[model samples]
Target: MLSGFKLLACLLFSGQTPTENLPAQDFDEYQCSGNVEIDFPGLCALLDMKNIPAVCTKQPASLTTETEEEDTDDNKSLIDDSSIWPKPCLHAELESEDPLSAKNLKISGWRVDEQIVRVLQKMLLSLSKLQSLHFWQAGLTDQMLISLLNTISLCSNLRAVTLEGNPLPERSYHLLLSEDSILTHLSLRNNRIGNEGARLIGSALSTTRSANKNLLSLNLAFNCIGDEGAAHIAKGLRFNCALLFLSLSNNQIGDSGAGHLAATLAEFALTHEEVVERRKLLLERTQDSSLRVSSDQSSVGQLPSVPSSTSLSASKGENKAKKKEASKKEEKPAANKENPKSNKKSPDIKVPQSKGGKQGSKEKLTAQEDKPTTALNEQVEAVEIVNPLLDRLVQYRDGELILPGNTTLSSLNLEGNKITEKSLPLFLTSLEMQGEEGGLLRLCLQRNLFSPDCELYVKIKELMALRDALNKNTSEQTEEEEQGAQC
Candidate 1:
């Protein structure tokens, strides 16, 4: 029989089960002091290896004063009580002078109670350099997930997260993919997510005002999504531009869901709502431009033309001399009598034009000459202005305007669903359309309710193969150019 400390080390390293008859005195000598760098002994002590229970229990809630309650209204209790629990298991890539250099943290096969939650929160906050976090079968609840996601949003460097085999009661997995979240990759496999959760996730992916722009890959496989959920996700795909990979395998989706997804990959006419939205955006942009131009003109006109004191005094003296000269001329009546013809005004007096008047005339002529060019430019700009939130606008045959579907998403995984042969033609047509536009390189349709030798399926695979080859060539060329530049 191994001793308690050695047994715990073996269990942690060898991935073996802990024995039931461990002595209490064996682990009593080892203790944890909340160190940032966690060792096997400290981890075993924190987990209470000597008193291992089949089920983990929640910690008793501590009583707090009214002031403390007010301070913790935003769920700060998880982060504030750092000294109450030991640190979590954090792995660092390289031991360096920097204390917060832990990069990866994986917690597996553990039931996360209140005590473990606090320690995990504290460790996440302390490890500023942590990047990826994986939790497999850690028994996370809805409340725990909410608190954990709230804490994760504050972590700047953390980008990728995986929470597998942890089913929550309320299906609140969409909270991790919020609009402001900075995570780039997320996996929520086997979480029992339903259509309602899928709807919320779609809304988070692309909302009216903003969308999740940081996330690149999302995995929602092994869930309970259906046609309605697929429709909701397709609605989101209409405007989403950042997501590159999406997996919806092993769901309950059927022909309707498959059609909804395939339609989003081809050009379709814009609905009334989208048209109104486009018009509103254009009007707002035009109003902003006009206001900016008016402000610039007003600023130019408000510029102060300051003059020197010497110039002011000289102008006053010149005005006084001119008034005296005018009076002397008025008093010379005899000279006026000698030159009576000077008193008569000329019939045709040629008025000398001022520089300002000449400049104004030239500006008017130039503006009149430029009107045609400005009108042509405005027409060109109007043709080019498309909705930035949605995909591009296209002009179809028969003088109808249409909107192109999502072209940013490169790969879509819908394997092991309930799709039938009826939906194969739809996907094939969509893929052909996408191929013409050089979009949607891959679409997974394996293990579904369709024949492998289906003609439409075969055509789709061929087209995808050709597109993949083209994309590979392009990527290789770009990589070679980058290498040459580095050299």
Candidate 2:
């Protein structure tokens, strides 16, 4: 059993879509209290809500505070201050004629008691001034949602309502949302809304009644919006320009889904011809800049001024040398291609079938399941981007972008993004520009869900070799400088 555990253990230790796990010390310094180099590099688990490090959002005017009371019984109370939760910023009148009736809204989980009724009554009281309401995951069923929606419609102030994470089916939710003309910010994350729900949302977004003019942000991540849903959403996007940010992350929306959005953006640019013309102007300007630089480099040899400027320019020479060294290093990834060492990262296969399941019916995990692969072909449609900066490079978990640091490194592991042939040139160019010793020394691109023909593999191999050489050179230079200082 121990031996089997050893084999299957490696299965748990693999990279996801775009996060390449590397030793932490390579990028960050975490010296132990008493021990050095004890910690291996691992990512803090990056979920949707809190992956990017802290950025303070605006605090609501008031916060509900709860105090815990020592429970004499066996029950642990998780929702002590569930009441007094502020109303959703977007709200509407519930049942009261008083326009500013939103003074009492509960933020706690709904209990089927007098307290819950009091909270609902308070919310109902706020309907006159309420523009939106959100009750995400608080035991609100389909009937309850419909009832709330129906109740809110009576108030002219009710604009938006969010009942995300509840098991509200698509058809009923759509009709309700369509009726609310002033609703702009809708969150339906982690819901079972398929294509039907998306189109319904789309229909609501297209509305431009005198009462409801602009709808800005729509967050519908983690929905089951496959290609069909994306197309419906794309249609909504085509006609609507009032919306600014739309988050559709963590759905079944794939390359095709992205394409729909991209097409919509292109359509938007086309609709507003000024944007198209400006892009052309910018492209021309970039080409002109490159030409001027190339001309400047070429003209240097003919002038007497060249020697003084060129001779004293040790930093420029150093860059050229690094570029040359990096070019030489590029050969290594090609060699790795012939003998891809990364392919053999995990030979440790283990099988765990103990107390968790029926004894001895060990769950077998397949090598194919463990190793995901794709192949890019001539038929693969590549996205064309006008801005080189926005092009996808390496990314971390949850599609966060990863660029090589300002130095060289020894190991790299960038998973969570699909970087392929089209972006290959740009990626390499960026890596090259990063220099051989890209403050990041190691380049590890393993266990990513990229095409088998991912030229990035080759690019990483070359970058790694460059990183190794630069570190070697840097170490040597440091030693020489130290010796010179000693003398």
Candidate 3:
């Protein structure tokens, strides 16, 4: 029998060795369909990932985790190697588990590149005891996903993921989503994926709709997943009931996606309410219309005591007396309004309106008049949403400070104190703590703040480090200078 590791490799990469998963850039790297020969050594040489004798010191393929015995191991700094589980859903779940355990783990339902995916495949299979994972456009591919699936066919818990640029076929992604995932947060954004990819992922979500309810938040933005993709996701969400926060930004997922998602959320929220007013109205209109009893019955009134058989005669006698008294009083009212002789004459009385007529409607009309829209909700109509966060985070427009009117810079995080230089970059890096969306990572400082030193010195240094790391990982940076402060 093949070893578990080898079996996993065969399962994911169809028996391709790590040496065969290398990148050559012979054809376009974006295309997923091909049987191209890979030279792992050559690719590692081209990229600075190889740990070749004295020639290349950096380890190619992947980063290694330092693992120790479970309970007996007392190294406070060491973490489990996650190279053990390779399956997508299983891997994501396992990686998220022991949130404080794994160091570098990667798994999700998205388009993964080839070479980068091979490293992930191995990482998933070998580092069964891994800790955390941080992936931003690390060349994940289709065949490698198969390897990933094989590496981890079963898992219980997964931690978090940051996937931005890795691309995978839609069909494959949906298959991954089909698995039971325990991951709480997922970030998959900016990957040029379209509706087909979204449909696949949505299909997976629909399958694991019950178990994956553990997911608290999800970010799918800046991908080209338009209306159809968003529709599929909305339909999937109908089966999901536990999600709290969802971000679908810059996908060109226009009004249709917005409306569909909004409608779904509104419908779900209504269901959770104690008394779903709209649903009650709908139920009354559709299923209970024919059962309509007379509305004239006062919903609230003093209860009349039931008369026993012995008391029936007395009750009837009392009713007759009451009617006689009412008749006498009715006649006396007119007499008091007129002269003494004419006082005995009964006067013409106006008839009360029917419950189904204008008298009943007038009350409702008055209620409606009193129930005007709140000043807060309607007063915001003039406020245009021109991505205030963008205007705030990106202060330099043509080398000038262009603070849009009424923009609150989230990066500043100046809630209880005045902002200074040291506090800003701490706020910016805080965003990096919020991992990937499309495997295309863009740090959001609009939601954070950096100290002036951070804005000037610290952030520049950090940006340079970020750029070096990202540049080392992938050749996707075209305008890295704008990453740091310009103004």
Judged by TM-score, which candidate is best?
A: 1
Candidate 2 residue lDDT tens string, 179-270: 33455555555566778878776665542221113455455654677667776776565445355446554456544544454344321222
Worst 10 residues of 2 by lDDT: 371-380
- Candidate 1, residue 113: how far the Cα is off, in Å: 2.4
How far in Å is the alpha carbon of 148 misplaced in model 3? 1.0
CA displacement after TM-score superposition, residue 163 of candidate 3 (Å): 2.8
State model 2's lDDT: 0.39
Candidate 3 per-residue C-alpha lDDT over 126-219 given as tens digits, one digit per residue, 9 for 90 to 100: 3444434444444565665556655444433335555555666643544344445555566665556678887776665542213244555565
Q: In model 3, state the lDDT of residue 457.
A: 38
Model 2 misplacement above 4 A: 1-108, 111-132, 156-160, 207-213, 268-487
lDDT of 1 by residue, 397-476 (tens): 22233556778888788877899999998888877776555567777788799899988889888888877634555444
Q: RMSD to the native, candidate 2?
A: 28.9
Native-to-model Cα distance after best TM-score fit, residue 296 in candidate 2, in Å? 72
Give the Cα lDDT of each candidate.
0.61, 0.39, 0.37
Using lDDT, give the best candidate's number: 1
Show the colliding residue pairs in model 1: none
* RMSD (Å) per prediction: 21.4, 28.9, 22.0
